[model samples]
Target chain A: MGDALLEVKDLVVEFKTRRGALRAVDGVSFALKPGEVLGLVGESGAGKSLTGAAVIGLLEPPGHIAAGSVTLGGERIDTLPREAMRKVRGKRIGMVFQDPLTSLNPLYTVGEQLTETIRTHLPVNQAEARQRAIDLLNDVGIPAASRRLDSYPHEFSGGMRQRVVIALALAAEPEVVIADEPTTALDVSVQAQIISVLKNLCTEKGTAVILVTHDMGVIAETADRVAVMYAGRIVEIGPVRDVIKQPVHPYTMGLMGSIPDPQGGAERLVQIPGAMPRLNAIPVGCAFNPRCQMAIDRCRVERPTMRRIGATDVACHVAGPAETTP
Target chain B: MLAFLIRRVFQAVIVMLTVAFISFSLFRFVGDPISTMVGQDATIADRQAMARELGLDQPFIVQFWRFIAKAVQGEFGISYRVGRPVMDLIQERLPATLELAFCAAIFALVFGIFFGVYTALRRDSWLTKVVMTVSLIGVSLPTFLIGIGLIYLFSVELKWLPSFGRGETVKIGGWTTGFLTESGLKSLILPTITLGLFQMTLIMRLVRSEMLEVLRTDYIKFARARGLSDRAVHFGHALKNTLIPVITIMGIKLGALVAFAIITETVFQWPGVGFLFISSVQSVDVPMMASYLLLVALFFVIVNLTVDLAYFAVDPRLRISAVATRG
Candidate 1:
């Protein structure tokens, strides 16, 4: 926490629509420490994935970072030139896409893809790069890694292909990896396996991970800290245990309630009333005010900034004062 | 790989046989070859003797079988117009057509791919707009009209090149090639453009669209995410995927160029097989017509086989699946 490896301050992501510019990620901010796993949890369209993409400078055209800075190791990376940013991509920050099937080029062998990536970032010859690729596949727990190197993406099953993707992301041994819904497209049984492989590999390499997902259960199992986002903003962020046990923001409370309690028999899951507002139609103040169960008059009129409350930082006027938490 | 080739060859044989059958039928129904061969002075008895000698009096199936047998041996009897062996006539004309089609193909593929890739990568540039407009014009204009336009521009107005003919050709063995001499290459410019314009535009549009589609795929995005250089991403990955479908189209288009170079050849008087076929049609030369039909079918089959092999080379998925199915 003292020396954050990756720091994102006041990040703003906006898309230029025909009507006007719509803010998709509105002034979201977070910091990641080395060897730490930070989970970004939100429903679809909440800007969680956009936040991750912005950090690595991979936001698609027509969408861009409007204002704010992404700093890595005391240098502002968000403003670097295209070529320099590209070098920093797999060299400093790796990324894993959602679908394993589409992430790999079907024309090339996995070995060719992996070795090419390795050579792109590292000052290594072909032989060295291939050796490193083999080691990487082995680290990701693929069986017969050497034999499987020449196999194409279609040769592997969904789960195995994801493992290959993880290997590819970690090929350069970057300081940070942005895994956006890495396991979302996998089977339930295989999802845990991928997560465990990801967790173990990142932990072993001492690399920080920004895990963006909608599954709170995954966050509970993997993340040391968690940020709960809603309507393109972080409503609450703190250690996983503290936020899950004692959620200060009403949105976080509703999110926690929705997860069925396996131990508590015959209890219905909680459903939050109303959907998240579209980017253009977000409420005037505290974007979540329309669906908030504990919204006060101030919550609707004056947008609440994140205030330190105990160990957690929450953005809600109705939440108790900072000094009230033990 | 061997199995695939064997299957393709077998299919090619069936296609050739079918094409041969149709041409054989055309020989029987179309005007009398004896009437065209003997001129207006022959008596009824003489015409009957000639028909019998030519095996035209035999049953249709027996005549067809004889045609097939002679065709298999690269013999197509005698041409009514040329009064020489049909095979020898085609042999003399085939080289000119092959050279023309070859040059046109090179022109079309090189410029088509270049323009396609350029426009796709620079979709919003003014140059791209101009290129797209030019391609539209190329696609819509008819071949003969294009040939005449080029002839008007380069020959009529500029007086820079010859309007027709293959120019100075060098004889190498039995093959007469126009590529060796300066005027020959110069003379090829107008007809090549006329013949290749439609194909080039078709290829350009296809490559541009496929390139755009491939650029949007997740693999391309992933390639960029890996910090690959723009060259490696665009050419090495995206372009390879773009070329898969382009290869098949190129094969078909190439076959069409050779088979349907009639208008271009006629306009230029290039002495190619296409020009020969047109004259043979006018003279009702059945043997020449049948031989040309078989040759075009053979060209198509060979091109398709090459396209399939190229698919194996570029795409690992296809290659692996082919092996899997064989196993």
Candidate 2:
């Protein structure tokens, strides 16, 4: 019970489809303490990105939070009005998107874009904002900060643009940062650089971060704690090392085994077979039962509740006591 | 950038030459201007002498060369019907046509973009629906019908404005203030509105669509995510992206404006190049027709060139590529 910077309890998000109302994120609960990084790992359509969007109050139309309580820095933000939520969005909870190239405007110079954010959140004049923009560019590792400030987003490389995006998120010195697959668009070599920059900056500022990524390697390298989601529900939550080295939930184990290790010799990587069910046609029982290798008879008739097993939390009837790490 | 400009200038010259040659050939196809102007009842000797005097009997290539040479030297010859210098006739009427087109274009750009942005921002709202419906009608209705409709409403019904003609003369230096005043503007109002209404609708639709598309870009969403205000996202980010296509259409529309002006001027009996052009065409005045056609063609080329250059200013990517090519 360290002081939680953000706490999402019993969060449920639903979308009204042509068929009927479909729950995308159901009763998901998570908390982030100051200076903590919570990696939300899930397959596509697992509602990880939707969760991030809900946290920031940007869940687009048709998909909305049906039931939830989101407390940020001691304030209940879930029920806050639109104007109030907007004030908290960039000033308190910043967001970095998946595609860095499309996440920056082509018309504006990078400096102009950055300065606009600073000016909006801060009580600063144009000259001060401009100076802050130059400082941010320098902080983000862009060369010739002053000169590059005038350069457009297209002028920068993919990784550099991601850095600029991070710079924008950190411009107002927000309390939390939600980076949704920030490195997914960059090359593998550049991913590490961006992750390191983000980690170092968050650490220095004691800002909580919610990193939504599907890459397990990114989670192991950057996250303090990880939440593995399957079909829009968190199947497992624990310390990064514990979850990766010894996963409790069957789905988590399948995810960990799916990754091919470069150091290890040729081994058939275990993959969770079958596609995720569409949002409109979810199974009646546990969402992962169809894909779970160790699913029992009860797993097909009832959804599992998240129960504590030693140091980890798992939502599976078959999840017994935690196994000792090898 | 300089290379682009040079290439554009060369293209413009080719366009002008094509216009000159086509209009010249087309006017001749209708028959010799001298014979047509003099009438069919004239004696064969009189017609032959008239043809020879006017250089109409020369070889087609030689006639084209002579026409081009005279045109370049500002000697457009005399109007066969008016019996006055074609240049003098055009000079007198050119200002009025240019002024009408300029004013209409300005009105269209200002109101069209403003309405477009407003509707896009308020998409699916009642205001947007009304604007879109109006735009559809404006685009579908022919310019003549709109002009006639406006004349009937403003002139025949309201009687608040003049129905035809340029109206009473005002002092040259005081023209700006005089023309924009209640009465001065009243005279030009019907034609300007008729021209601007259709163009404004077209421009508005273009801007609205382009802005809507630009607004959906991830960067605009990111801008909102960064806590930038709605104004910043819509105007600063979205609007800037929309302007490129809008400008491109506007350039092409300017050429259309000149062509439309011909019909508008005739309907209103306004003293403009369009009215002069219509009369020249009716009376078989070849030099007047050629000069007017050449000017309109030149207008399109220059406007398009300006638009091409504007692309460099709006997006640095173009400027960079342009520079790269030059280097």
Candidate 3:
């Protein structure tokens, strides 16, 4: 990217357990450009969500960033003190969690939540904040925004509540938004609507977004660039279309193969054999070596670093032209 | 809201009637009121004449109906032990008992919530451990023993306060209050603490566990993520949710404080309804005992009703549901 808005370098997150220190996110790094939508796609426990939480300085206790440098607008943020970092979150970088139903405080109305957030970061009076909250709700496509301001979370349906959560996140007009599985908790019918609403609002504001999700289809629909993670490391990262059409990493290829092709007349979808290794029992060299069909002796002996191929960067020892682009 | 109130009131009426029936049967079967009324020297003819005069010779159903009617009108007849109207006696002692209970409830609620939130926030601190240990003792110790212990310390040993009685009370209109005057206020401390200790500990434990649970909820995490100050997140978001269950417990415990203040009252010899109740029991005063039971049951009904109404104030979900049903 010509000018990156946010940069995460050599980020490593570890949890202190009774057994010992267990690394959850191992040396993950990526750059997000201004106004660009960067999708982080991975299976569960793949550290996609953890990485997002780390960037915002919100890793729960016992789980901390062991070693990392996160920069926003060319200024280092990972090392900022707690109070200073709090100002950065929801002001410089907003967050949208997985479940909208639980994301909102049930005791407060949507208006109060939105306005309180707005007033927390911005230098505005209550009346002005209230007006801004109404505007934000309207921007997220909630009808009668002013009238619905007094309604509690339970009064709204799942989709409407999500819209309110998005409005609250965008109330401060943050430079970047980290949405972690925003649509996963919604209905299939409303999932697309929520994604479109999120996409349209961020796009309109020229706000950069880090969309963390496990759905490759969602990434295709919303992300400008995509990073595919496996076992807490990025297996491949590139332009969404390029990575989807020509995945070089074996893990990414297997992932793309597993998704059902709606147009193609295949009765059964391709499935990757075996399961991802647990954090405690990950193989020393290539974490995917045991399950990768093209694993060689070298692949078993040493982990591969990212090597650029075409428009994508992949981390696989056996990545070569032998496996044709599907 | 009106419908909810109406339903609650209806339920309260049923409860009161059930309690009334139980107390009625207790007075009817527990002792012979005529023998106590006439004294031991009265002949059989005198006893029969006295029974007829009091309508005790009527059918059981008719007598019970008359008792219920008189009770509704606040007439519980005369106390056999004191030779006074039971209602008048209760009314005279009512202020002392209410004042004692009210003070105890306030102490328990304020300190319990404060200590609860403090301990929950600083769970790993040494101070929290000490508070929890002390609260455990407060919970485990019996009420009368706690009262006696306080009296021995503050009254007998230190000689700082009076050991027994409501000292130098002031009468304001119909209510005789010990709230004013230095000695009267000093007299209340031991009894209040002794009565409040168990409820305070119970509320503290409840609030602490609830606060811990609320802190782990997703809404709390989301609030933190939204960059709300730690104070705002903890108190504004988490504490409000924690209080929903605490309110119910506090309401029920407050009612229990009033009904069961008999032990603390007897220990301190505070002139309250519970003391009267204890004395009436010793003398086998059926009218006083029955009326006391009815009064306690009535107090519980009012407390439970207030708690239900308070839920509507604290939680918006209930209010919305009520509106939805109405619409």
Off by over 4 Å in 2: A324-326, B171-181
Mind giving the per-residue lDDT tens digits that candidate 2 earns over B1-327? 666778889888888999999999888876557666787799989988888988888998898899899988989888898999999888777767877888889889999999999998898799889989989999899888988888898889988788888776455642322264566567777888788888899999999999989887898889888888777778888998999989999999977788789889988888888999888878888888999999889888888988888888898788777777788
Ranking by lDDT: 1, 3, 2
Q: List candidate 3 segments past 4 Å from native.
A: A321-326, B33-42, B49-55
Per-residue lDDT over B1-327 for candidate 1, one digit per residue giving the tens place of the 0 to 100 score: 898789889999999999999988976777888888898999999999988988889998998899899988878888878889999999999998998898899999999999999999999999999999999999888889999999999999999999999999999999999999999999999989899889999999999999999999988988888889999999999999999999999999999999879899999998999999999888888888999989899999989998998888888788777878999
- At residue A138, give the lDDT of candidate 3: 92
User: Which structure among the candidates has the greatest DockQ?
Assistant: 1
| DockQ, cand. 1 | 0.82
Compared with the true structure, model 3 gives a TM-score of 0.96
Q: Which prediction has the highest lDDT against the true structure?
A: 1
- List DockQ for all candidates: 0.82, 0.81, 0.72
Writing each residue's lDDT as its tens digit, candidate 2 over A163-201 gives 999999999999999999999999999999999999999
For model 2, fnat equals 0.80
Clash list (residue pairs), candidate 2: none
